[model samples]
Target: MGLDDIKRRIAAAEERAGRAPGSVTLIAVSKVQPEGRVTAVLDAGHRVFGENYVQEAQGKWPDWRNRWPGVELHMIGPLQSNKAKAAVDLFDAIHTLDRMTLARKLAQQADQQGRSPHLFIQVNTGDEPQKAGILADELPVFLSSCHDLGLSPSGLMCIPPEGHDPLPHFRLLRRLAHDHGLPHLSMGMSADFESAIAEGATHVRVGSAIFGDRA
Candidate 1:
């Protein structure tokens, strides 16, 4: 689908959720997509994108950044502590901050590099052991630790279990953000983004619906 089509979908979701126009930020997920596809997206005037891997983003985005000003990149996949500096340097925001070790690494690197992207604490709302997010019950303390480390996180993010209804997880994330005074909610994907909007998502990461299926 094209930019206009995605914008219309987001707009429709916002209207259904009683949100004013432009309240939700649409992040075009460019993970695993080639340069030509990304170029097409840029040519279409989209400035925000999401990537799942640091190495892949490093390989492609520097050139893209040089050519297109004001492009914002978000790291939306699991972040390793060793890659914290690279991630901090490349992304404008990070949506997968789940552990204290990585948070500390990011904080140190961001301070040293003199740049810090907006941080979001990822919560495993469904309590799935295999997921890479902090469990829901542990969020409070982890959030506090981030604040103590001066990360100053701005929101919460989650990937609800695949086959389950995602509304509850979205709602839980919304409440967590509110209780923590976080203003952004980076939840949902192509399938449940509309429902995520209904639960007050400020940023929705959409991949397939916008760029077609990844190879």
Candidate 2:
């Protein structure tokens, strides 16, 4: 899909929600897509992108960033603690901070590198058995633990269970962020982004809608 189409969708969603224009950040999820496709997106003037794995991102984004300094990379997958340093080194933001051990590791990496990527606490709003996130009720204590470890996250992030209406989950995430005095809400994906925006998503990670089916 074209960038214009994505922008239009965003505009329509924001309008429906009565949110001011540009209130949300569109993270074109480029995970598993080829380098040429990513290059095409950059050539089309899109900057922010999300990747599912740190190693996959390392293969292409470093050179791309050198050529286009305006680019911003976001790590939107389950990050392993061992890869925390590499992730902290490359990504401009991290959207899957789900555990205290990872938080502490990221904090250490950030301090050592002298740069800390913006963090989003991933909450398993749906309470799914297979998902990687802090359980909804554990969010408060987890957020507090992150703070104690000096990993002050920007907001919350979640992926509602597949095949379910995501509106309620999005709304809950927004409320959680608000109650915690957080400013950013990174909920929503290609399928339910509109609903997420209507509820109050500050960032939407879209993949298939923008890049077509992954090859």
lDDT of 1: 0.92
RMSD, each candidate, Å? 0.9, 0.9
Off by over 4 Å in 2: none
Q: Write the per-residue lDDT of candidate 2 for residues 151-194, one digit (tens) a residue.
A: 88998999998899888899889899999999999988888888
The alpha-carbon deviation from the true structure for residue 75 of candidate 2, after best TM-score superposition, in angstroms, is: 0.3
Output the number of the lDDT-best candidate: 1
What TM-score would every model get versus the actual structure? 0.98, 0.97
Off by over 4 Å in 1: none
lDDT per residue (tens digit) for residues 33-109 in model 1: 86788899898889999999999999999999899888999999999899998998899999999999999999999
C-alpha lDDT of candidate 2 relative to the true structure:
0.91
The whole-model lDDT of each prediction reads: 0.92, 0.91
